[model samples]
Target: MIKLEQINKYYSLEEETLHVLKDVNFEIKEKEFVAVMGPSGSGKSTLINLIGFIDKKFEGKYLFEEKEITDFSDKELSAIRNKSVGFVFQNFSLIENNTVFENIELPLLYNGSAYTDTKARVQEVLTKVGLADKASKYPKQLSGGQQQRVAIARSIVNSPRFIIADEPTGALDSKTSEDIMQLFQDLNRQEGVTIILVTHNPEMVSYCDRLIRVKDGVIVEEELVK
Candidate 1:
């Protein structure tokens, strides 16, 4: 569903140019659960941002379902991103003051969805992520795992075709992390949402159907385990 060719990202600092990604090329198919593994400075997060349409300054062609999006206008990018992509971050990114229901409802609100439809979608996703009971609770009232679930619910509330998760379980304990992985697995299998996750944990890699390892900003290895 996504492809990148000859991708190169460079940053200029003090008259010195630092290349973040060099000749990075990869493709992710629909409904595929792919894991991106790499050490620090390996450009894993940068690549995710590119795929998620958060970074547009890189030199390369990014095609989503055969349409080149590299030169898409900011408004166009925002539309596509809101409708086609969902994001789960390590920090949870939930609004502290909003209730779980409200946080998950924010996306639909931004998309101009009808109030009734937005309410239903938020409830459905919250239930899907096992956060229905916590709908009225604030972020601070929930545990780390519950907060993460709320974040996941918020991402998928719009039924995005793809999910880009960066260190999704980084702040959770082992058991909670496993639960989150299982939730992602179920989402990919049942909902057919293509999931691309960046993780440093070996255990998380084992849960993915395919693994891609990056070193020095290049994909050095790719393996299909399923």
Candidate 2:
């Protein structure tokens, strides 16, 4: 479970301090698929960063799995990001020169895994994402949908509890986006991985169990779709 209470975030500028998130309170239960929707600059990305453990500077009480976030050590936080959370961005963040297998192996390498283990895990995720045959190809050789599949493969190789996707289908066509959303749904329902997606597309948001809508730095609505 994840809960945020009275969360507030701000950015400092030479002339002004821009408040980005305000009193953002919400609860995401285990195995729930949630979508965060808003227009540009609505703190959607900021909210994703916070949930993904990519941002540490903020004011609020953040509790994850019944533990207070601020009490965790740096190493523990790193473990949370590595072992408990996965992230997929709008832009597929795969390495340009690396083969698909190598890109998926990167996270395990960062986690200090042995070469044999990394290869096994990468191959497993490749098969899971239906890209087992393209492991030898580079990012430039794959289409947008394929590249995003590679990104998703890399994200799940760690078997994270929370898959935080920020506009994951933003760069794809409608058909391809539907495929990706279906994949997310499969992961949530079958694997029971809790998903928090940040997207502007209602078509995409409709795939989720609930929508947490934001506007001008505040949560304006939350609706359950399923």
Which candidate achieves the best TM-score against the true structure? 1
Q: Name model 2 segments beyond 4 Å from true.
A: none
Return model 1's CA RMSD, one decimal.
0.9
- Model 1: per-residue Cα lDDT over 97-210, one tens digit each: 898889999989889987777777787898899877888999999999999999999988888989999999999999999999999999999888889999988889888899
lDDT of 2 at 186: 91
The true-versus-predicted C-alpha distance at residue 88 of model 2, in Å, is: 0.8
Q: Considering summed lDDT, which 10 consecutive residues are worst modelled in model 2? A: 47-56
Give a tens-digit lDDT track for model 2, residues 122-195. Answer: 88889888898999999999999999999999999988888899889999999999999998899899889899
Using all chains and alpha carbons, the TM-scores for the candidates as numbered come to: 0.97, 0.96
Per-model lDDT: 0.91, 0.90
**Where is model 1 more than 4 Å wrong at Cα?**
none
- Which clashing pairs does model 1 show? none
